[model samples]
Target: MLAFSKLTKSQASYLFSFGIVFIIYLISYIISPFTSNDTPFYTLIGRSILQDHVLPYKYIFDHKPFFSFVLYGVWDALMPIKTGMFTLLALCCAAGAATVASSIWKTNRFLVFFILITTGAAFKMLSGNTGVLQIFFQILVLYLLQYPSFLRIILSGVITAFAVNINYLTAECLSLPIIFLLYHNKKIIFNIFFFIFGVFSGLFILFSPYLYSDPLALIEYFQQQKQFLAAYSPSFTTRLFTVIKLFCYVLFFIPVLYVWVQQNIFQKQERIDPNSILLGLWFVSGLIASCISGYPFEYYYILWFFPITIMIAQIIKKPEKNFKWFFMPIAILTLFSVVDSTINNIIKYRNIHAIDYVKMASLTKGGSVLNIRALQTHFYMADLKNFDPYLFKEHIDIAFGSRAAAHYMHDLEQKPLSVLLPYQGCEIGAVEATVCHYLHENYQKIYEVKIVKLSGKIDHFSFELYKRKSGA
Candidate 1:
């Protein structure tokens, strides 16, 4: 074993940081196999691709491209369906942790620890979401930006394309190419070609045979996205909180802003270097994208944090003792926030008893298992087999979310389907009618009753199994 005593401060710090991150990754991997919402959906899609050979456009609810292909591909290849999702989620978490560690390493090593503790990076890793992969690509692009070689430029473009496939919002980081063009004015043509190649490659993967029967499905997908954007509402309070959270997420941005301000006032020539301009533009672009996206989720905004963190590091090359103090409170707050969020998530996971619900639905006979107002459809699918612990029934038709139900109902010829509606947000009459109409065109007066809990709590207004009267 290598001795720590003989190593220099920098070497020792690097090793220690790697060890800590690896340990966190290992722990996350161990716990990730437990059931979660999206896990089964991913598995289903992957299985569909492999077993049924069906393109996913008609079945997958969301219009986003087949971005999860690689993730699911690896999952199917490695473990059994359910186990694969957990393993893949764990790997994604590891990749994300590694990304954050590298991005922050150049600037301030302490901040990485702070991010892990504050962000509940470990918990997020176990959550089995794509946020980690998103962060990984962001850092990869930033690292590539530093190098000026043709191969690096091409690689960066390819990575950016892959990033977009993983999550369309990640395409926002393509702005990095513009920054590169500005920095390398002499090699503009090369940058253009590199970008075009990457875009085409990404488009090909996005529109693979597994995505749609016809390539036009890609166009339909974009049209849907347009509608979604047009209908989005801006939340000012959410925007303000996001801004504050990002600033606090990294302690150095405040100082970086101050530096930029000082440079502007003094009209300093050296301060306006290519690097500063690139970093400034990136930060601004990311901020605008995050703000405009509306109803900002934490992971969605975290992608931009990588570049901002790196920029902040570039700003504070040599710091005073006083500067270190600035990070203490920020670090403490971040740690607290991460811990709090992790604990709350854990509680929610325990309370939901998601596996039990899935199993129960699987065992119920004759009709499809409908989870109204459910968040993650995949988790429900994963639990179907487990619910019949005695191995009674083999499989059940599982559907969740308004969109998923809508899609399924559109294809079904049967009427009077029984559904188990969860106690979600306030039930809207119009929404329910719209859902009901898709299943049955004609109205019929059927038995109706309000479902109430044993504790005298009003559960839901149930239209007791409505079906259209024949020839009515």
Candidate 2:
């Protein structure tokens, strides 16, 4: 009921900026090209939660923290939409963009442009990776830290703890940047003390469910997670890509240094450069995380988005006026790339249906459904149980993957009711002789679908749905 005329310029500007950010992200999600295998992988955990009325820590298989799975569970209960994840993703990115817009300008054009460019990359490659969300939280903390207030510091600490629960690698790399931030506080001791205290406070919230269920179960979960990631360190090719991406990210900072020097040296101004140093640390942390990631996939680039965009904001005096013509071509090119990706996704992102198999699964209660490399999105949609609780099935199938997978597949005496093989990437069934032999002996192929994805040429995939014999 409030009138617009009654509002101040700041309020109106804030709302306008929020609207712009929201629309950009909304468009990004609407035109998104692909859904990650990760989407349904996490969805399976949510289904487990709904059935069990508690987190399924008993399935000591996956490495990710338990917090995200709980939120996914709550989301499905309320929204119950397949693409609901898109909304969650867009909202987080929008919030971060809005924060930058509020400080930088009405548009913060460069920041928005950066997000659109990289967001397309994310949808194409890192769609369901947690790195994007982690950057969102990191930006939020970055903004809050600008004020250096006691309350803000504590809140930053709490949010950071939550961020770590999302992805241990990216957040851990931020340690030096955080230390740099703490050094700038007026009362360093008090802020550091409270920050650590707030971190423990956040940790309590993260661990409460496990503490309530069974204390030792938490330790067991940690062991299982470690057993899985123990062999996940980067390979030679991964490390090479990490170096290349790091070099590319460093190029973005030249403008930041240009701005920093212009303001401090040329203008003959004397001021602390803590923000610059912190921003540099932010970039370094991302490089470190990428190096540590067993595979420096495209998604890892998401971490660099935070520091780079923030640095751009600091560099441009008037984003719209400064960026008017120079960035116009870049903007067009970025959008074109994204649009091309969208078109490619529409044509190439194949969804090999398994309706008949899911329906058959429904008929048989207390039956396990095995999904090979293809994530079992359908099983979760039907609220069915997974044969293997380790939802990140690809990692389990890879070279030097978790030993638990070896033990789990050691005996195939009791085969699953339904098995899905998308016969595409990795084809672990072709590599693992024991598993291949077991499938050959017990399961029979009942349904097959051949789908063609054409980016440049036709890439055909044959999906085979298998069912065990009546009394196999």
- TM-scores, each model vs. reference: 0.65, 0.78
Best by lDDT: 2
Question: Deviation in angstroms for 343 in model 1?
Answer: 1.7
Q: Taking the tens digit of each residue's C-alpha lDDT, what string does model 1 give over 69-88?
A: 55655665676554335645
Q: What local lDDT does model 2 show for residue 412?
A: 49
Q: Which stretches of candidate 2 lie over 4 Å from their true place?
A: 1-34, 54-57, 100-128, 148-151, 249-267, 272-277, 314-316, 319-333, 348-366, 376-378, 381-383, 399-411, 424-434, 455-462
Clashes of 2: 0
Of candidate 2, the 10-residue stretch with the lowest lDDT total is: 346-355
Per residue, candidate 2 scores C-alpha lDDT tens digits across 336-404 of 545655444444234424235465455445777676655455455455566666445465554245453
In order, what lDDT does every prediction score?
Answer: 0.50, 0.59
Residue 361 in model 2: shift from native, Å?
A: 5.1
Candidate 1 residue spans exceeding 4 A from truth: 1-47, 69-73, 76-117, 120-128, 149-151, 176-178, 181-185, 210-213, 232-280, 308-318, 352-358, 364-367, 378-418, 423-472
